[model samples]
Target chain A: MSTSTEKEMWVTKLRKGWQKNLPVEKLLPDTQPAYVASWIYLFGVATLASLGLIIATGLWLSFEGASWYHGSNVGHFVNSLHFWSVQFFFVFMVVHLWGKFWMAAWRGRRMLTWITGALAFVGSIATAFTGYLVQSNFDSQWISYEAKDGFNSVGIGSRFTVTNFGQMLLLHVAFLPVIIGIITLIHVLLVRAKGVVPPIDAFNKELGERK
Target chain B: MGIFDHFMNLRAVYIHLGWFQISITNLIVVLGMLVLFGLALFLPFPGNKKKGQK
Candidate 1:
């Protein structure tokens, strides 16, 4: 009974500290509202949705057994879903990148957010490369040989083997996802912390012009 | 590395030349692009602002 009471007391203390550090008031934005946007703004959300589909389809494919995926109808459908997910992933990523570029979103203490996202984009390419190799199909074999030369030329062949199924699978399924997920979390946190930048005119106009 | 080795290495090019291979490759590429498009709906990349005005 005493031990349980002490545990409860510790929990209460932890809760109090959390409340003090992250009050609702502190979390609220001090700046402009975030809903301002055109239809293009929806692209980012679409990208995330596609990623969800990819993960779902990938899980289904993973359960089908490797050899089954190559010849079975159910496996084919799952593979199709995974394939389409990847296609949409790149499209959404490109659109989102282009949108961000046009917005000059790196300004006003938000530069690190932009840089981390750019790095995530680079990491995504690596993830995609591994995904291609893990297919274990004819194309996989052919691409592996072709890609090896490029990798070797860059001196990365010593450490990163494209033909290694175990390594590629682990990296694609585990390592890359963790990195991508963490970067995405950090990106979202930074956005929430900084709040959205107001319209350029809001900051650029003279004092007399201010409404 | 003689011309023969180069030719042997390029044997994969013949594989690409096959209609079946070409179709499969195109299918994969198209599907990949489609997936990227679908994803764009959700995880939008934040954009940069216009130049010189920030």
Candidate 2:
């Protein structure tokens, strides 16, 4: 018999919370609404795929070390792949954002989803900036030289230290990625929980009639 | 790999319009993205038919 003062275990409470907020069916639905058949929806998945590739290539580069990537031909190829993956990620993410904006994806109490996505974009920019700062190339040195003044003007240069390769490397490889990952995860979970926003035409008869 | 080297070594071509300027590579990439976005809007997605139809 449990005492009246007995407190629930934190693990049990956390499990219950997850179950309440995100059930298995909601988290992994087999079917989507008919309106999900648009090609614009594909860009979000493309962005995810590119992000996966970027992480994979980045991991490979990290394992290979700076000397390998800087000196070896295979390392250069891997580095190139990482770079291209980033390019694709940005393109796909931007296209997805634009498509969602045009469709008014924030409708139906999904403002938090939109906010998370916007935050993820901002976080990605920081991540990319740090990445450029850590490249150890002439371009990276030039970029850092130009960027230091901007950071100093904002009174963050003393702390952020754009000129410090080690600090920038840690931020790029570790900190910013984690922040972006958290934001992206939240955005995706919100999408799953709230369901994709229906087309604007679903509400407006005149818009529906135009199609 | 040699082909990649050749491509990488190729000089970037730039377009100039008054004060505006951009590399051909950047221009192609941007134009390609726009075309893809347009096509995505217009293309007929498979299985998008009415529920009663095949």
Candidate 3:
């Protein structure tokens, strides 16, 4: 009987703490309306969607064994999907980056968002490089040979071998994904924390009126 | 040995239809580009936001 009472008391305390922590009303207070300017904001969404497709197709390719992909018709189609996904991914990502740059979207209290995004971009490029190396084709061979000299000159060559299939595949498929994923998560959190940056003209107007 | 034989066969076929294979690859790439262009038309691109709404 005593143990049952103790358990009930503990459960009550835990429930109270969880309720206090959630305080959804406090978190979702009314703020400035979200600016959904035309369809341009969709570029970020499109890039994310392309990344989703890439991950799905990449999983499929991995399951089939990388070697099986080059010879079989289905494998070739999957390879095409992966290639096209990368191409679209880069195109949308570039547009998203340029869009953020021109808007000076780093303004307000969201500098962390901007910085995290920049880091993610760097991570994505590294991931792409590893991907190129893992292709195991003439392109991969050529890029590996050419890139080795450049990497060697920078002293990072000792850490990452462009010619090593095992290392490159692991980096491309596992390690870089984790890094980029973490950066993306942090970036989204910062964006939600600060909300969207206001329009530049509004900023200019506020400054002008103050003057 | 199994994978090597498959690749050798693929190479043999590709060698015989060299130009055709290349053209098909180019066509696929072009189709991919076209798909991207179509998406660009529908998707938000970031610069079209209104100027003064903060």
Candidate 4:
């Protein structure tokens, strides 16, 4: 029953609310706290860089088709890049997770940030699993046969059949990537919004060492 | 024509201990990450000294 003018006002209100919550300065800060100068902060960026390479190589593979990579020399090279990128991605991501956990990065009411980052990690793992299934090789066939029992035991095999090459490929290249990308975006946004957590000593001193 | 030709075609080396076994490549990569993480934790990062000076 709302009028057109009232509906338009709601859009304006939404826009203003969004900007208020995430202003440009906070979203893209030029300067960070001096504690961020530590080498520990590099792992997060390293993880991000590996993810970028992964997406680039994955996109190229998708363009050429999954089966094409099996026989072509250039395709093999690109496929190798894709595989190595996953290795690097997992290495950096696990290190980043360790760094954040040691620092208790969820402090200062940043639980959502921690949750989103963890979700991104889990989603990335599933995406990588599907990538293995779609490799279109004897290894993939062996993996699929091995994994099918586990999926079937969980009663999700019919919906997400590991034996279905088409389903696994689409999940690897399209579905899970989108989910992981969204979760990663939210994680980054939350980090920017909340600012990096302070060092333990600094935080303890600020709180009068109550704990 | 790829730069990693030699690296890619190397023989797969494995270490076996009783029933446990792991490829040398995986062992090296894991060990390398551990070393890198250790270095990152202890190494002095540049630019922190001048952080608040100006």
Candidate 5:
């Protein structure tokens, strides 16, 4: 392994990155602090699980296309599951965000983690908005008309019209999902790179500064 | 008591409390949001953070 002050090399940088930021013991910890048994700490994992369900049901929906989903009983069941999963994702993620914000989770060189998490929350809103616009129903049409004025007021409607079925459908299934996926990926990586932030009072324990 | 003859004509499910009435669906949504808010405020976190016992 290259020392911290060693001369630069691409391969050495990769080795140093893992050594300094993500040692295997920290990256995949088997034993969590006893304090980790609480429910709120699991919100991140809950949201992740909900996202997995959402994507799984979504792929099933995309495969069946709009006809089956709108017409068939089984498709409706899967759609309902997808809807509930999205609701769970938001509930868990928002609560998690609220918990982190109150805790000032940015402490301990974790600003990037907080930023990525916040961006993911915002990206989720856009993804959901496109999702509603692409629903292919009277409700969606009404929502598109209602939402267009707000987008126009912000000068974004001309570029991304909610009424454009083709554009909105593509955005919902492709663009927004991709953006959300990237943000979520970065957020998780940041959390892994910086080990879970301990409770403030735990700082008084044998916790040394992160190296 | 309401007439049983009109039972099949009923579509609106109402919960009556003295002077006020609300639909079951609206009640569920409102109560659900309140419950969610309460959970958000009081959910137990690691380190007993909710009670400052850490």
Candidate 6:
């Protein structure tokens, strides 16, 4: 339905948009400001690494059945790795969140970055909660049984009943992880587009660090 | 909070009054962080208070 020139023009326009918003130099920066050299910035990378570990280990656990995790030693090791990564992911994410909050990292119209990061944190928590429910053990049973009442009290028991193992497993293995991945990618892209926020002192003398 | 096993051991503030059963642990941690962050932006640097007093 479109002419060739018009189609090419649209493609060129999109390319220009990407270049202006997130040039390759900023997208893959070789250097950052000196002020970024602190323990806080490191937590972001650590958190991301922990997330990667969790997903990698989760894939293995999902592939092998109950016999492998409980029967085979390697499966047990991988299962442990996944569990520990979930713990570390939360730990690192919270530390990073605290650091950013202290720095007001959302300054200079970076609110979307902050918002996406917060949403991803929440999605990760939901994913972890489902992971515990999908364990297929006594612990899972107890948690799932206990969780039913809470869901019913809130009147969403019918749609998202944790007592249903099949539904929970499907959601844990697929749906939630996809949501978390997409949101995290958006958060990272927003950070790249916005660049890191400068310190308050760098902005003004009197306003100083108050900002 | 005791109903949720993992959270049971977390030393969370719990309230059970009639139909309302809530744990303030999550609330406190989230709000506490925000409050501390807000305070950091103002205090330890002679900033503003009640306008007439400052």
Worst 10 residues of 5 chain A by lDDT: A202-211
In order, the first chain's TM-score in every candidate is 0.80, 0.90, 0.81, 0.92, 0.88, 0.91
Candidate 5 on A91-199: residue-level lDDT in tens?
7887788678877888889999999998999989989888887778777999999999999998998798989999988888888888889999889878888877777
CA shift of A66, model 6, Å: 4.6
> Of the candidates shown, which would achieve the greatest lDDT relative to the real structure?
4
lDDT by residue for model 2 (A53-153), tens: 98889889888775577778888889889888998898889889989999999999999999999998888989988888877888799999999999999
Pick the winner on lDDT between candidates 1 and 6.
6
Instruction: Quote the chain B TM-score of every prediction.
Output: 0.38, 0.74, 0.41, 0.69, 0.57, 0.40
Model 6: per-residue lDDT, tens digit, A1-211?
3467555577778888999999999999976665554556667888899999999998888889644687777887898898878876877788789889888999999999999999999999889999899888888999999999999998889799899998988999889999999999999999988988998578586565454
lDDT of 2 at A178: 85
What is the C-alpha lDDT profile of model 2 across B27-50, one tens digit per residue?
A: 877887888788888998887655
The model with the greater DockQ, 3 or 5, is: 5
| Candidate 2 segments exceeding 4 Å error | A1-13, A203-211, B49-54
- Models ranked on lDDT: 4, 2, 6, 5, 3, 1
> Model 6, residue A178: what's the lDDT?
95
iRMS of each prediction: 12.6, 2.0, 7.7, 2.1, 8.2, 11.1
Better of 2 and 3 by TM-score: 2
Worst 10 residues of 4 chain B by lDDT: B45-54
Comparing to the true complex, what docking class would candidate 2 get? medium
Task: Point out where model 1 deviates above 4 Å.
Answer: A1-35, A206-211, B1-54
Model 5 DockQ class: incorrect
TM-score of each: 0.67, 0.88, 0.68, 0.89, 0.77, 0.75
Interface RMSD of 2: 2.0
Best by DockQ: 2
Error of 6 at A168 (Å): 0.7
> Can you write out model 3's per-residue Cα lDDT over A153-190, one digit (the tens) per residue?
98989988898889899888888888888988778656
Rank ordering of all candidates by TM-score, starting from the highest: 4, 2, 5, 6, 3, 1
